[model samples]
Target: MQIQGLHHAQITIPKGREQEGRQFYCELLGLEEMEKPEALKGRGGFWLHAGNLQVHVGTEDGDARSATKAHLAYEVTGLEAWKETLRAQGLVPEESVPVPGMERFEFRDPFGNRVELLEVTEDPSL
Candidate 1:
């Protein structure tokens, strides 16, 4: 048997700072907050669903550095509209880059988390 797909993803936020995480991931990014399992709630974490993947944010012991190198990429249909929406929320969207087979733009979340928005187009050679 082979691995099918990713079930969940976890991001670390400093202890007692989940509000900031919620503001960015939930409010700004438009992800809906979901309740964590009762067993895992004691650890202080929240879950959100994106498409079919689950994103988990857990509180860490101390001041944790932001993950700039790693990022979550989201594919959207209305790329321009999304860019405008981000700008209206005071989040700047960088110019789209040609990724050989896709179009993408990079933006940072309120917590300085790097995220990429991508839209795939029909291959010219197809």
Candidate 2:
């Protein structure tokens, strides 16, 4: 058996904090927000896309904890411009990430979820 690529990744934010999710994920990060399916519309969250990848931002209590170590890496274009934009918002990333195949840096969202923006220059699948 083989596992395919990811279907989606979920992150939690406090209830009534979806607006901040919108500000960071949509407005600041440039992810395109999409309508959640009808069956899940009332659950109090939203979906976003970067390329074909889905990130589900869900609502929960303020006690929702974020991992300080793990994060999601999204392949990006115009990475230098992103650095400037994030810096302007006081969301600076640590740019000295020394991954051999990826030029990447990581930052935290408003809800404290860690995320990495990477430009992969090599095919690891080879």
Candidate 3:
């Protein structure tokens, strides 16, 4: 059987730092917060409405996040504007490796999670 698409993705923040996570993911990033299920409400962290999918930020011991290359890359429009927006907040966007027909950059969230924003420069077909 063919697989379906992603339902959600999860990232972690240091335990007891949920407010910081919310500030970065919500206030700065512009993702809207979603209510957690009752059974999951007691757990730390929150969910975000990201396009059609959800991003679940869970709380845990997040000491090693910056040491890994694992990250989330979001497809967006107006790449240059995004870069400026990030810079305005004192966040530097690092140039990413070249990928045909795409312009992109990455930056670490306050909690060290690598977040990428990319825009299609040409038809995506290869």
Candidate 4:
């Protein structure tokens, strides 16, 4: 059997802190906000569209903690420009090791969630 692409990614935020999640994911990250289904609206969360990926934030039952094991990565066209944009928003972008064949950088979301910005090389074999 073959699996298709990702349908959505879910991140858990502390209960009653949906607003904080919104500020970081939406306001800081510049992800376009999308409305969630009516049935899931009462669940306390927000949906965002990141390119072809859908990011969903759900409220966790307890305290919020950093997601150190997993992270979401985005491929951008202009790496330097995007890095500057993030810096202007008061977010620091850290230089990351060259992925075997990709140029990438890493940064943390307002909630300390790790994210990577990669620029695909013309020749991926590089």
Most accurate candidate by lDDT: 3
Local distance difference test, candidate 3: 0.90
Instruction: Flag the better candidate by TM-score, 1 or 3.
Output: 3
What would the TM-score be for candidate 2 when compared with the true structure?
A: 0.86
The TM-scores of all predictions, comma-separated, are 0.79, 0.86, 0.93, 0.80
List runs of model 3 lying over 4 Å from the truth: none
How many collisions between residues are there in candidate 1?
A: 0
lDDT of 3 at 68: 86
- Candidate order (lDDT): 3, 2, 4, 1
Local accuracy of candidate 2 as per-residue lDDT tens digits, 1-126: 999998898888888988888998899888999889999989998999878889888998864356566677888988878888998999868875587877888887777778889887788786
| Candidate 1 global CA lDDT score | 0.79
Off by over 4 Å in 1: 61-67, 123-126
User: What does candidate 1's lDDT look like per residue over 1-126, in tens digits?
Assistant: 999999988877777778888887888678989888889888886999988999888777642335456877887778888889899988889865577777789887765667889887766587
Instruction: Count clashing residue pairs per candidate.
Output: 0, 0, 0, 0
- Minimum summed lDDT over a 10-residue window in model 2 is located at 62-71
So what's the TM-score on candidate 1? 0.79
Query: What local lDDT does model 3 show for residue 23?
Result: 88
Task: State the lDDT of candidate 3 residue by residue for 1-126, as single tens digits.
Answer: 987999999999998999988888889888999999999988888999989999999998847889889898888888899899899988989999999999999999888889999999989765
The runs of at least 3 residues in candidate 4 whose Cα sits more than 4 Å from the true structure, single-residue gaps closed, are 61-64
* Candidate No. with top TM-score: 3
User: Which residue pairs in candidate 2 have backbone atoms (N, alpha carbon, C) closer than 3 angstroms, thus clashing?
Assistant: none
